[model samples]
Target: MMKHQIARVLVLVSIAGTCLSTASCQKTDPNRKETIPVCGEVYVDGQPAAMLQIQCHPVEGMDTQQPTITQAVTDQEGKFQLATYEAGDGAPVGEYKLTFVWQNFSAVAASYSGPDKLKKRYADPGKSPFPLRVEKGKQVDLGRIELSTK
Candidate 1:
């Protein structure tokens, strides 16, 4: 269920945010108004990062200067939904940047138990960073992004 949702969101991002003109997705029904879910998942050392702050921003000069639009934080299972407006009123299909930031408490940092000392530091400071791109109406699966606390 979780993977399915993520796939859907990734698809939309690909369709709407791709930079290449060829990245555009063909409209089978151009006169319809529909909203689709573009989901995201964040993981750290094979574990889901819950409640991380994630935002979607346009690619600056490449498209409309729409500020970063944040999506709901990943749930316990690292699942989140990216909103898509009605067909014609949707985001101006173009490039986008996805950022994820999260805080990791000392208790959690001490649990990684490995050669990831830097990861401990950043996670302890509640500073996690990872960037992904969106392609408007296509799924651009970001897969897993690992951050270094150091």
Candidate 2:
């Protein structure tokens, strides 16, 4: 009877350990909203614009009061993946006005600051020329965006 009880306790502890491990393995955030992949490439003056910052501002018909702006930074090849809640997780479905800002990275300041390389031409959402619509359940690929510094 003592051996049986010990075995039962061990089994229970093993089951509890398994349950805890499984719960901890889950990566989903309870508050995360569903998202679809959004990617694009950017070019400035016909050349790949690396380290450019892209922002997606919610437009009319979407929640702007507590808005979540989707954003991404261009890779060396000018490629970017928009993320609203997590890296590369994409954005929620909505109409958005796209803004761009290219800044020079200062290693001395450990930041990407200084003057806007694009001269703030595409920095304001109110004055942005790029308007996009992210659809539900469908990946958005805003093919090569062309911008000008002049």
Candidate 3:
């Protein structure tokens, strides 16, 4: 009699614990932004432009509780992976204006500042002609973006 009641109580507690754990695990914040992967390469005068920064800004009506600006750094081969919400995660779905900036570490260190090797027009987001869109659950591959040294 007493043993049966104790067993029933234990079973009920276990069921309740499982339900609570499942609910907590599935919980998601409504304000959390969703993102999709974006990647590309940068080129200068028909060659890969390495060690540069690439940024994407929402064109319009894309802002949320989370930021829409996605940024990436180019590798040795001029490859970049955009990250908005997290590292290498991706960017929110929207139209974006793209911009670039060369690291110029050697020039900065040598104090031989003259002008950007890849043209100054590529730096400003407002003036940049590169416009892109990110779609949900889709990976966007921006082919070689060419820049002129002259």
Candidate 4:
């Protein structure tokens, strides 16, 4: 009887351990909203614009009080993928105004800083010329956005 009881306790402890491990392994957040994939490219003077910062600002009629602003940095190929909650997870469905800012990289500071390469022309969402609409269950490909230094 003593041996049987010990075995039962061991099994119960193992089951409890498994349950805790499974619950802890899950990274999903209950409050996390659904997101759709968004991708695009940037061009300046008909050339690929690399290392530019792109932001999606929620416009009117959307949740601006606690808005989830999606953002991305252009790769060397000038490609970008908007991420809000996680890397490459995309943004929630809404109407957004796009903003772009290209800052010079400072090796001394070990970060990208300094004045805007675009001269803050695309820094304000209110004055942003690019208006984007993200639909439910639909992927948004903005194609190529052309800019000019002139």
Best by lDDT: 2
What's the lDDT for all of these models? 0.50, 0.90, 0.80, 0.89
Per-residue CA lDDT of model 2 for 1-150, tens digit only, reads 999999999999999999999988986766566788999999999999998999998887446454576899999999999999889989888888999999997668878988998999999999999998888889999999999999
Query: How many pairs of residues collide in model 4?
Result: 0
Q: List the residue pairs that clash in candidate 2.
A: none
Which residues of candidate 4, in runs, are more than 4 Å off? 1-5, 24-27, 61-66, 107-110
- Clash pairs, candidate 4, are none
lDDT of 1 at 9: 99
> What digit string (tens of lDDT, one per residue) describes model 1 on residues 34-135?
333456576756677765655555545432332323344567877666554431133334445555556542455543233432334333212324434444
Q: If ranked by lDDT, best first, what sequence of candidates would result?
A: 2, 4, 3, 1
How many residue pairs clash in each candidate at the backbone level?
23, 0, 0, 0
Worst 10-residue lDDT window for candidate 1 reads: 119-128
Listed per candidate, the RMSD to the true structure in angstroms reads: 18.1, 2.4, 5.1, 2.2
Q: What TM-score would candidate 3 get against the native? A: 0.70
Candidate 2, which segments miss by more than 4 Å at Cα?
24-27, 61-67, 107-109
Can you give the lDDT of residue 6 in candidate 3?
A: 100
- Model 1 scores a TM of 0.43
